[model samples]
Target: MKVTIDQDKCCAAGTCVLVAPDVFDQRDDDGIVILLNERPPAELHAAVREAADVCPGAAISVSEDA
Candidate 1:
């Protein structure tokens, strides 16, 4: 699974980071979403997806590569 974040759309709610800290983070200054892992392992895919789902701004995007 691949993860991407739209910083422009991110509300910096920190939900993504809370859901998947290993895959997401926030900028200290503006509190924008940061992409820690563009390509996370399969084991982390579920968390990454959950993070995307709970994102208040819907800033998180995910793509699955076969």
Candidate 2:
């Protein structure tokens, strides 16, 4: 799976980080969503999806590899 985040839409909720720290993070200064892994491993797909689903700002986007 592929992951992307929109900094402008981010609310700094940190939910993505909580759900998938390996795939996402936050800037220490403002807590904006950070994309740690643009294309995470297959094992991390589930958590990445959860993070995307729960993002309050709808900043997370995921695309499955074809």
Q: Report the CA-based lDDT of candidate 1 relative to the real structure.
A: 0.91
- In candidate 1, position 33 carries an lDDT of 94
Candidate 1, RMSD to the unseen true structure: 0.7
What lDDT score goes with residue 18 in model 1? Answer: 89
Mark the 10 consecutive residues where model 2 has the least summed lDDT.
57-66
Candidate 2: count of backbone clashes, pairs at least 3 residues apart or interchain: 0
Give the alpha carbon lDDT tens digit for every residue of 1-66 in model 1.
778889999998998888899999999999999999899988999999999999999999999975
TM-score attained by model 1: 0.95
Which portions of model 1 show Cα errors greater than 4 Å? Answer: none
* CA-lDDT, candidates in order: 0.91, 0.91
